[model samples]
Target: MKTKILTMTIYKKLTTKIHFFKMKIGINNNNAGIIIFLSVFFVSFNTALSVTKDSITYVKPNEYHGLLLNDTSNSIEKYEIQRLNYSTLYDILNTRNELFGMSLGLNGHYNNFLSYGAIDNNIELGINGRSLTNYYNGKYNLENYSPEFFERIEILKGSDAAVLSGHPNNTFLNFQEIIYNTKIPFTRLWYAQEGGSFISADAIFSQNFSKGWNFTFGFKKMDDRLAFDNMSTDYWNLRFILRYNIDSTSSLSISDNFTNNKTITSGGSDPEQSLNMYNPINSSPYYGKIQMRNFRHDLNVTYSKKMNFFNITNTTYLTSDINERALPRFDESDTLGNTSNTETQIGNRINLDFTFDNIEFKAGSNINTFNSEGTNFFTEYSGVNWNLYSRAELKFTKSTSISGGINYGDDSKNGFIGFGERLEHRLNENSSIYLDHSFISKNGLIYSNDLENEKTNLFIAGLNLETIKIEGYYRIVNSPIFNRLVNEFYTEQYNISDYQAFGGSASYREQVLTDLFDKNDKIDLRLQTRINVIVGNDELKNYYPLFTFNAGLNYMLMINKSELNIGFKAGLLDSKTAPRFIPISNSYITTTNNVGIQTTGLNIYSIMKLGNAFVKIEWENLLNANYYNVAYYPERGQIVKLSVVWSFFD
Candidate 1:
């Protein structure tokens, strides 16, 4: 099969310059950590003596804009700063930096990070208003687009069957599009290089036209090597967005995203080599090949109107995706047996919202249709699924509220019903408590013939006390299915069983040492800590971690014209069953024993404003810990990135 490849001439030249720049800045391989620490301390110490600002100003909140799912009509400001910080690409460096109590694990690629114990199968990917969850025989690769392409990302921890018409156990990741609105044209160019042979470049252009019309376009390219061998990957992506406002209360938006990614599958390292944490070797003598090309388009129309007694809003969206992948064996020969898959999907959703007094109601319907054709015992299949849902929220008093919803869907082979309810009570101005429960039955995917429908029951309770929060949940699944290695070559086959899990997490955050300093103190200190524990049945325990702990401290200094932010973070993951690579499938299957890993790192970032231009420098993993989120795939060591943004009005 033919695959797309981006030119490497520019990338090679840029990396050479970046290496020289690193050396000129005194950031060599050795002593980089010490230099970063001293630099942060020195700047902070000097700035503390000449305080010019009152307090640290954190990143602005990405408000909970209304979604098409339900009509919860939340106060836009209610969720502002609910967490210590927002989720950004910086958080990808350390799981401890996650503010949503999520555990993120990465494979070799930056876009292949797994969330909540889910490999690629159990999690759903959404961009703008499109869903790329369906897969034929290949992996659902989310690494096609860069983080810079999205304005903000929102993670919904648990399942919301009524709102999200997909599998019940999957977590929801929503990537919001970057809306362009500038008086004058805006353009940006960015380049970054890491320790390894990893280089990336991006360009963005945006303009606003007359009568509330806007257009934005972006292009990105990346070339990265995963191991010491020739196991490398190249990716390219293009995105375009256009928006037109019919009036103040109505608008239409359209987006198109295209991506091409090629990766070399070397089967990772052997068991013995992986066991040695410090110096692992890729023992696989065979190198396979895999490539994916995806194109997605989304169109959304939204309108809102006010009535005498209530306000009504409607949102309708149409999304389509075409995906293709080719996988060949490790012998560098496609003649023996090569596999390929081509899938096309189209989905649409329409939602209506009505708000009156202290009650809000929502109704929505969705339909998804997909077809797949492939080789290697891959039969042609086509299917259409539809769902209908309704939900309502009522506030009895200022301090108490209740919400519930139900959804019904049919996937041709089976019917699914899901329902959920939640009740919340305010203990004080800074504290609240909530209880929630959900029961859902989900139909298997069209491609999985042997896997039967599954049902799950979940119960959760949580308390939020200002800077301290605690949450717990219990889940039980009937007829669950998971992939297991079937042979020494790491070929995976699906297995069906029942599973149960119980987990809880506690997090605390608070500022310290304020009283010891003067009234005009220039230094500020904040501490954050979190602990997560999960226990599963024997079958399920073999695939997920048992315990995770993270702690970090942040310091801010008020400089004369700029502010400095520095932080140190550390995380520990208790031993559990680890995964081994399956080259043919380009996936990982669980192994028997457990492998404990620890990660520690320091991050220093500074944001400076010079008239209309803003500059930021971020250094991640200064300690350069040698660790692996997966068994054999080693994570990136240390990285340095610099970004600048300039805005001007004509």
Candidate 2:
């Protein structure tokens, strides 16, 4: 209780400081106060104003009134399906591995630009494909960064019988979950101030000639130190969006965002050492001026109509270019491989959704093309890849939905691979099941010789329940794919086909006190668990188990005109097996025998509100537990940050 009180007092004092400064800076406006507060809490300026509450708390997926999703479903008799939206930095850091393909299921990665439709804290994530150890030489950051720029973030699980055409699938791919992040423009001008000295400004203008046609543009810039060690970033984002409603049932929309960013690392380099000194910080010389560039563009359109028997909707997405850094393993080390890489991805998705009473259907197709080129030691390897797939789902009733889909594509330089058919069935609201089969073949092109194709079979089942705000779920999955010599990057032709995997996960959350102190204030507690296993050829163990557990306590408090909130979360994970690099290769290899539950660490955050302003503070690795996010590298220890914000309202 003493700790909680102290945290609250600090936050309240900080909030007062923020408000006082805003007024002293010649920004004497109530709305200005709100804007300042929101910017600090949400860590964004892209979304200027929110008529409704931006969020109940300061970070992504913030919780309000003991509810995760903004809205609830009333059709369900027993459980109110609630979607989780707020997640912390730990949720991003604790995910054990990547989900492999597509963006579904429970993956743990940071959603830098927080989008919606995610479960667990690990759900909304952006992953880096390239290695982190060699960033200095400029291998180009191959990471998918998710930033938060939405007014509200919401996640929907289950079959989504109310929305999409068909019943949702029980499997990751079959699941029709949608994350919606809404953005609303402020009637007043847009503006902001960032960095230590409060440097700020805003830009917004628009013109319209026709009733349905309009054009608008906006630009905002903020330079701030996100952390210590001179780790400051300059962010300049520009956006242009146009929308035209053609009649009533069809509409065309186009938008583009250009973000220019500059980041500076303050750490210096090291003296030369033997091969044993593989650590980048210890062996390589570091100078300032390390930089990165990114460019992304997307286009989409939609059409919908209500018919007598069935409602119809058509949507399409075309993303052209998303390009990032190109460089070597390290600038200071000549022994390290020097390489440059750039990739271009073009993709298209089209879906047709229709409904008949309680039964619904969704049919869609997707195509993607990728091209990559390398320089230096990797210069000889340049390739193009393509993938095409078609999917469909049928909903027989509210409680029962089934789906089937097929995928076909060619790697061109590699070979042809295809998925025959997949099916899913929902037994009831709390449980469901699924089955899948696929065919794969690979060719020797960039790194190795010719390899034979293999077949795969997969199965899964799920169960979920929510009682009195308590939520929990369990899942089992069986997957089989062609097993290869993971240690060998370039191999003389060899075949080892037969890899399998099984995984399970569960979670729980309960409100310990609503109106514990105030009618609008409350306290909550939560717990989560996960497990995974894999089997088949190779060393490392025929069986391994991965588990993760998380717990947290949250409270919302109010004193007079001020409102205060605080929360703490801690997690433990045991991966059983750690990754080992194959000598002379860039890939990581691991065995199935690895098993054990090791403690990772803990994280905590606190928030306080005073008048219209708020303060937020966070500390990571509370116990100073040393753990590796990667095989040899130890993650940072004991980090704390304090920020204050005020929102402006008319």
Candidate 3:
């Protein structure tokens, strides 16, 4: 089987049922530690051969389900936070970038990064157990807000994300809110800049106004330019919360999360990579000129109660999102046209936890009512969806445990039921082995009630050792949905296959440098590698990169009232297919088997800290290697960014 990117040359404008996805709700709140959902998104252009005459109309994957069943990236700790100032979510994720079939691409844009070779937006985003996913295009563009806006940013990756809702093919990124208990008002402020241009500012306040009552607020803003021509982004986020403690075990909280953003793009690098033959290059036309403005707001009210034997939580939320787009009609003049879309999601979630001797159980339900009113390019759509799920974990011995559960969901015209199980056996304090299996179903941007639901059978196995960890997975899909990622490109295609993917990852950690200097805790190092092979049908055979690798090393020293830290890291991707972005539609297109060369990029970066306050100076694409992960629309070049945080807490 030969995997290839298929693209269409002729750019077309066709308005149809928009791709929409439900939100993922992670109810455990703070304990919802970071998760890495590994997924591969395959885009179709139109042919198994070279791209036809540098086209525009292309592909999309409709919230494809991804992988990373039981693996999680490194957790963000206070120490790491001190080493790496909390800025954008992309900044935080850079600490552990893409892993195993994951692609972090389309830089210099909004919150859109990290994709599995699929088309469209493949990741879903949420906050405090509520979804931030948009119904218009089934994406939670990772733009605007900074990770500092939340107390914890949990990455819900892969099948493990079943506890939440979204396209099964999507990894859910949920930001957990900060809950304060200080009687005296406290505040924290942060600011950062690069190349003398202000890039970020943040403010947070917390206070306990009265007994059993607490309030919190947070704000963040940023404006900056990237290496791309006619490319820039401005954004801000605001959050407010009020909580009342009914008693030690019960409380009620209300919150509002609002975000707004604007981005200007020049489309992407010409798939042909040709220098403008016209004189006065500056006067030449911009083949792609696109601008997007959007905003999101969520209002939530939550109540929680704790008992000796059980814990319960119920939350009702309303989320509204609006998007405005201006782009050319694919005409010679590239004159711009305007389109807008809006969505509102009203949802309620009830979750419970119970504890018994050697056993733990959980059950939950979610109800969502969604409505979308379209504009120039979209059609109207409205629907209701609900989900019910339950699970139990039993510890048979100190070294052995088993867990399994099932989920059921339905809407007016479609429904699905799935189940998953896991078993773990501890070999020793430093080692263990486990197995995971699940029979699941995923729905992409649904348009017709008569369309058949997609189903998947997934299997995974892994082992954990004191200094090394490894995992592997196998998956099969029936009737997978794929789309061309070009601007205004839409297609309803079902491609079925068996045993589509098989892959694994390995990780290693040590303190080699520190031990050499008799400072065991002063230096830390890590190395990891992953590989994925797509042995799917002819259409998706060899399109995905075959391998990925990453490494990092850091050193720390402390002095009186001051500290120092320095580190360097690198990531690499190798493959023959490249992914490109289209600014107007916020979508991606592939060379579509049009790649004339095998493209590879090795990006090296450095980080440093001085004083007690954390500051970061990074050399992105330090090697300046030609690569696609950096995106192709605006043309990628080496960039050095310096950002620092000024805080009152110090």
Candidate 4:
């Protein structure tokens, strides 16, 4: 109870500070009115001479909420009826599911999150807008923001990146925006609670005005304690969206978001000592007091119009991020270390889509400029990049299509060009096959002069059978940059001349026991599996896993008016260099050789939905396995969490 009170008090104080900051920034009544007037005028002008459609198309309020209730039907359909499931926000908060194609490391409150298949090590450390990956010195600074801030998260895996804006060899995550348009005023209130002293509150208000004008405002606050000791997380966020329908073929949307967050770091323990059956778990040797404060603001505007034969879209965004960290040394000799980093970026994208007879064309260009500075860095860095891409799809028949694209990018540091081709054949209404190949050259990070440009070649083939999917891929990378632990708390990058990787994934989904029961009384089953193997001429084996595998299953049933979803997930990793905690920096350092232990573990979860309320229970490390993904950082023991979310809408 006291802890809860303290968390609330801290939140209140932070909110007060933010309010004062807003005042200092002159967000007073005058500016507020001006903003409103400009928004209204722009929307009005855009729709002045446009045609209105009789029917309105908009996202339903409960679409995302249904996912939290274990209803994956909509998401499955969105993914072309593939075997992908929606990850609930509760699961993310508890670190139960890190999503597919990504890995997450936990050091108390500090999180080291990384996306795979990036050759530019500096891009992993700094903010990379092209890929939407944000980090600070290899630590995931974006973890401070809650997933609720976004309308939806789309996971693009394997060859799916061929159509996206990022490197074709790596997976991409797209955080979609939220726009609400309804004939009547709508409001929603939500509250969620978890066993680990986690609490979240949210409110959303939206309305559709005359002349196809709509607006929405959303606010969220979250407070939580880490599963381990002396760690906590807290954040508050606000989002506003303004949307206008110019006509049946045109629309414009503007969104703004702000967030403030704080987290406390807790260094991990030594695996050898802690995992010993005969010895008691010992505290981390290099424990220190560390805290990080993060503030972020983003503004985005999008306009789309459809002409007689072509469609055009323009999108612009501006983002500002500030982070501050304070670390008190364990010893009294050194003074407290304080560091601050600030980054700002402005970017714009224009795309044109046209269709001529059986051929469809898409052309787009993106330009971005970014500047970053940090107290610990020797000097500030700034860069500008321009990317142009064009794609054409030829429909030979109703069942087959071939598409190809070429991309050229130039930056202050380097220039690169790439091309890809994809052939998709529909076997039937419920199945299809596709083959794709890509060759891409990526520029090095602007902040690092030591790194060189990198290139990759990827080939992928896949089959989709409505409820099942199978895919295989092979990739070769030249001058791949890999991260190496420099000291207890820092990492450096080294280039690998040649590297190769092969991987495959398969998934299946079906309704089970339907023959014995009615259609409405049947059970739903889902299974997904993936494996990867890496090889290289250099001694890169010690730096990366030789083999890795992941498998997951979910079984869902409906009883009366309630739904139950039960799931199990497992992961396996081959011996390789693994991360270890560095208390001083509140980050992780990698180990050399195969000294790191090969690790495996199983996790289980269940969700029950009754009306507008959902209850989720999760048990991590169900097998009580004693393993470590990172060296000297043992995995947590069996931990159970129960969470509940109640939503009300009108």
Q: Which of the numbered candidates is closest to the native, going by highest lDDT?
A: 3
Which of candidates 1 and 4 is the stronger one according to lDDT?
4
Q: Name the better of 3 and 4 by lDDT.
A: 3
- Tell me the TM-score of model 3: 0.78
How well is each residue in 348-454 modelled by candidate 4, as lDDT tens digits? Answer: 87777788888888777878787778455324767786777887888999889898788777766777777788898989887889888877676444554577767
Candidate 4 lDDT trough over 10 residues, lowest sum: 65-74
lDDT tens string, model 1, 1-650?
01111123333443465557566433334322332333233223323322332232222212222233332311112123121221224343233222222211222243344433333344455653335565453344556655556655555434353345444433445556665554355555454445455545556666565556767777666666644454566666778877665444444566666766556544544556444433435244233444444554444443444444443434445545555445555555645354455566666655566778888887777677777675454457778877787878889998898888887887666777878888889888778898877777765545556666666677777787877777777777776555665544334445456666666667777776442333422333334433333344454464555666666665554445444445555656666565555544445666665666566455555545554445556676688776555556555556665544433331
Regions of candidate 1 where Cα sits further than 4 Å from its true position: 1-66, 69-122, 127-130, 137-140, 151-154, 157-162, 167-170, 188-190, 273-333, 427-431, 486-495, 514-536, 581-588, 600-624, 638-650
lDDT of 2 by residue, 350-383 (tens): 4444555554454444344444565333333333
Candidate 2, poorest ten consecutive residues by summed lDDT = 126-135
TM-score of each: 0.77, 0.58, 0.78, 0.76
Task: Provide the overall lDDT of each model, using Cα atoms, as 2-decimal numbers.
Answer: 0.53, 0.36, 0.56, 0.55
Of the two candidates 3 and 4, the one with more favorable TM-score, higher being better, is: 3
Q: Please write out the lDDT profile of model 3 over residues 508-586, one tens digit for every residue.
A: 8876665344343377788887666666555555455676677777776655555556677776665546444445434
